[model samples]
Target: MPRERILELRHRGRSFREIARETGCGYGTVRRAYWGAGACAAATERSG
Candidate 1:
């Protein structure tokens, strides 16, 4: 699944469970992907 799409859904106030259902992924996977994307973006911002 696209990370940006997941992030967008999350930003739009979708819960991890909701995103998982929509994206056909596990709830844990959705949560991890969202947090991982956030971590990566934060790292990039700090580094840049």
Candidate 2:
């Protein structure tokens, strides 16, 4: 759920700090979630 929310915020062009504040998570946590999602998407595209 947190990951999805992070992604949603990122898609809306929210900064990491903004996401962290809105999600009640640390900035690094939000940043990592975004990077993790991007990595997963890249892997999926490559595999598909």
Candidate 3:
């Protein structure tokens, strides 16, 4: 799944379960992807 789509859906107030259903991915995958994006963004902010 595209990261942008995941972020967009999340931004629209979709839950991880909803995102997983919409994207045809597992709930854990959706949660991890969302959290991983946050972690990466935080790392980028810290680095740059």
Per-model RMSD to reference: 8.5, 8.9, 8.6
* Alpha carbon lDDT of each predicted model: 0.68, 0.62, 0.66
Give a tens-digit lDDT track for model 2, residues 1-48: 346656787789999898666656667766777777432333233435
Name the top lDDT candidate. 1
* Tens digit of per-residue lDDT, candidate 3, span 1-48: 656667888899999788777666777767777766432233234435
Residue 32, model 1: lDDT of 76
| Candidate 3 stretches greater than 4 Å from native | 37-48
lDDT of 1 by residue, 1-48 (tens): 656767898889999888777666778777777877432333234435
lDDT of 2 at 34: 79
**TM-scores of the candidates in the order shown:** 0.69, 0.61, 0.66
Error of 3 at 33 (Å): 0.9
lDDT of 2: 0.62
lDDT against true structure, model 3:
0.66
Better of 1 and 3 by lDDT: 1
